[model samples]
Target: MLPINFYGKPTIGGVIGFLFLFTAFMRKKTYTKKTKGLFIKQRPEKKCFKCQGFGIIRCDLCSGKGFVFYERKYQRSDPCPKCFQKRYDMCPFCQGNGERSFLGKTGSNKYNKKIFRIFE
Candidate 1:
């Protein structure tokens, strides 16, 4: 048995044990929130400049008429090979989605101002 007051000071072992218990009680754990469905990383997206969010554009070969008229054979019209008589083709710029994805805002501002290219 040991005296309650040994030299009027706490033992080193007592102090160390108290400190370990204090730190163990104060420690914290972190957890991530659970969400439904598979996780998908989001990225910045902007409207396509060429299609202007319409997803399609007039066919260049047919000029939106779906057929081309030739004067060599008494002015005969034929379906355009490029558009297959649809008169419009999927926009290559946006891949028919009318939207483009980018990693950041760098140079994205230029796309905000609708700028469609003209073809003759």
Candidate 2:
């Protein structure tokens, strides 16, 4: 049997500490790749003729300003009578931001091999 002193040597402690420190130091290294899918194609900006680029129209009643304070005898807490409530008219089709399209199917060959197995 070996002596307990042999198992508790400073060199053994140093080796374990060195290994722990080396692993910690190695984990700090990082690798990165510029993937093709990461480069997204930005859509070109298109001018919207409906809102004329202002993105909103004047309120028909308040003329788009949203407020008209008038004084008489009675006071009311209602919005402008001319504009009603909403100050902007969103695009009826695109709903304002202007881009519109249907996403098509993105085909994949990974499922091709499984089709024959399912039929069999």
Candidate 3:
């Protein structure tokens, strides 16, 4: 009988186990008909109001100059590390993606829907 060494070179049994694991890992998962439709529909994306779809904004640190002087001296200036000399930072509101979900209801009833449903 071949000695089973799980850590070392695979024996026949080990090879079989490996094949079993590999096949299991490679197998495609199937979703039931009911489950396939259970996922929430994605909301439409819109340009971020804060960044105006630019994905970046004026860096507060360098004031959009892309660099700053060590002590307001023209002789010595340091590249703005915050924006990598790009003069802009990732939009805090959009996280640099430049878009966000269009909030509130959509479709025909969107205009008719009351802000406070409890009052209706």
Q: Report backbone clashes per prediction.
A: 0, 5, 0
The full ranking of all candidates by lDDT, starting with the best, is: 3, 1, 2
The residue ranges of model 2 lying beyond 4 angstroms of the native Cα positions read 1-44, 68-77, 81-86, 99-120
List, residue by residue over 2-112, the lDDT tens digit for candidate 2.
222545564766667777777988884333334675743332255445554333445555666666656679754557765566665554433444444222111333453
lDDT of 1 by residue, 1-120 (tens): 222346668777777777877887887622233459654332225666777766688999889999998898588999999999999999766667666634212233444333322221
Question: What does the lDDT read for residue 1 in candidate 2?
Answer: 24
Q: Pick the winner on TM-score between candidates 2 and 3.
A: 3
Q: Distance (Å) between predicted and true CA of 116, model 1?
A: 23
User: How do these models rank on TM-score, best leading?
Assistant: 1, 3, 2
Q: lDDT at 45 for candidate 2? A: 56
**Cα-based RMSD of the predictions, in order?**
16.7, 17.5, 14.7
* Top lDDT hit: 3
Model 1: lowest-lDDT 10 consecutive positions: 111-120
Global lDDT of each model? 0.66, 0.50, 0.67
Model 1 TM-score, all chains together = 0.45
